[model samples]
Target: MRTVFKNFLVLAVMLGTFTSFANEMLEVTPTFNYVTKGNHISVSDAFGEVIYSGEINYSGNLTTLFDFTQLKNGKYDVEVTNGFRIDISTIEVKNNIVFVTDANRKTIFKPVVRNENNSVLISKLALDGEKMDVELFYEGELIYTETIDGEDVLNRVYKLDKTLKGSYTTVIKSNDRVFVKNFRI
Candidate 1:
């Protein structure tokens, strides 16, 4: 009986992984971003092969790698293109600025809100390339995790609950050097 239960559990887990992503690594082709009208959200290519789809902070000027000025707010679909499987594990918003990081892909993303002009800016960093295909899904369809931090720089993914927060982790490389921002706060 225990053996049977174990097999079922393992099968279930495999199915879950398959259904969640079509490929192993997050992938996107001809990257794109968008924003909705009423809600004021924007999604764009922030991190490596990742999308920054959410609200648009137009109170001030914003900057993103791709063309997000035409971005709108709505149910943004962050798809992993090029057969790369990517899942946004965590996202945090502060002072109208959205800070998102997919440690699952070893990347950090920051999307600032620009409500007045109805737009948003995207910034990010990604290292390590597992060379896996990627996919995308609707919200609440993926699972993320929260992690604890230490005294020094915290490495690894985590989750933040009960605060309109999203958290998770991903695999990355160490030898690769990609600088998103080098400013001191």
Candidate 2:
């Protein structure tokens, strides 16, 4: 019995160490639209000047809302660090659209839509040589779905239906990551 207890204690300590290490690898989501407010992440401008920094208040699951309303249209570096592990991303705001990328310089799926000339423009970026599954829903009905086999840092643009009104939801599945964005037109 004593030997079994000792082995159990060692196993518990090993599991605890692994959990702590995993928690140190930071995961961040930078907000682009005005749908949500309040900042739960840190951001720095291209010049490495800290623009926003604060601690995120935890409620239940990990969810963060970043306010980018005050920032002018420009490129910024956003970083999230826990202990010694750090993850940095670059974000660009143009017109009213925002683009975000990961540390490996791969664009993360954060699509934006805009109305122009009686048409809706939808744009997003994907990594080279990756297969992306895109599903777009208008209101609660699925309007479009496609699987794109990307080639060389793709900048994908889809001219949505001009008459498309009401709520729009886009879901992108790439590798093991899933990104969802919603907009009202």
lDDT of 2 by residue, 1-185 (tens): 99999999999999999999988967654442212222245688878799888765543222225556457899887755443223456778777666664543323444455555534455555444568777878898997888878543434555666676677777777655666777776
TM-score for every candidate vs. truth?
A: 0.17, 0.38
Colliding residue pairs in candidate 2: none
- Which candidate achieves the best lDDT against the true structure? 2
**lDDT tens digits, residues 56-113, model 1?**
4432222243343343322222332211223323333444454333443322222111
lDDT of each: 0.32, 0.61
In angstroms, give how far residue 15 of model 2 lies from its true place: 55
